[model samples]
Target: MQRLDATDNAKALVRQLAETHGDLMFYQAGGCCEGTQPQCFEKGGFFPRTNDVCIGTVEGYEFWVDKDLFEYWKHAHFTLDVTDGFGAGGFSLETPLGKTFQVHYRVFAEEELEKLPPVKRNIP
Candidate 1:
């Protein structure tokens, strides 16, 4: 499994979100401008693909991604740094292909989190 460096700010934000929402799912998806981007989903969203890597937990919350996707991006050698705040948003990962993937994390109200569907792998 690949390793991820969660900034102190990112950790704090994740902790706050998990405590308030129950859980968080981090996703890696194909992007229009770049190869891929990092997205954080509240509890009740889709899960990771079987080929993804599980990077352990952040702030007591579990996190993982599709193994094939992870490997593709891993070969690109990306780094992530998050910035937390009401309007400051999260961080971005710089992929080995010289593309940048952005991450946005927001506080999801209980009702909002409840409305989201469970996370699952997108097999294509």
Candidate 2:
């Protein structure tokens, strides 16, 4: 009953960031620049656009996805993963740390759909 999750690697990175940045949050803009990569921020730093969907959280950090994209991905689940290497052109917190936050997604099975938690929709 979840829409978002994180790999152990991602969780460890978040902890490291939190040590310096305090609480954190994330947004996947689904646009150019970051190009759909999840951007991490100090909690409450990046504001959510109207209609952004709160898919879920990891380590208490809220993770949001652009609503328009959510319409296309409504049936898919997301797992936040970190990759080794520089995040070219990405502005996420992790980008400066030689990492980029990316989403690994898959369509939910019928059984999973039924158990999925409802998304918290933002109205702006």
Q: Write the per-residue lDDT of candidate 2 for residues 4-86, one digit (tens) a residue.
A: 88999999999999999999999888676767778899988889988889999988989988998899899999999999876
lDDT of 1 at 30: 54
Least accurate 10 contiguous residues by lDDT in model 1: 85-94
Q: Which residue pairs overlap in candidate 2's backbone? A: none
* Model 1 lDDT on a 0 to 1 scale: 0.49
The per-residue C-alpha lDDT of model 2 at residue 91 equals: 64
Candidate 2 — which residues are off by over 4 angstroms?
A: none
TM-score of each: 0.52, 0.93
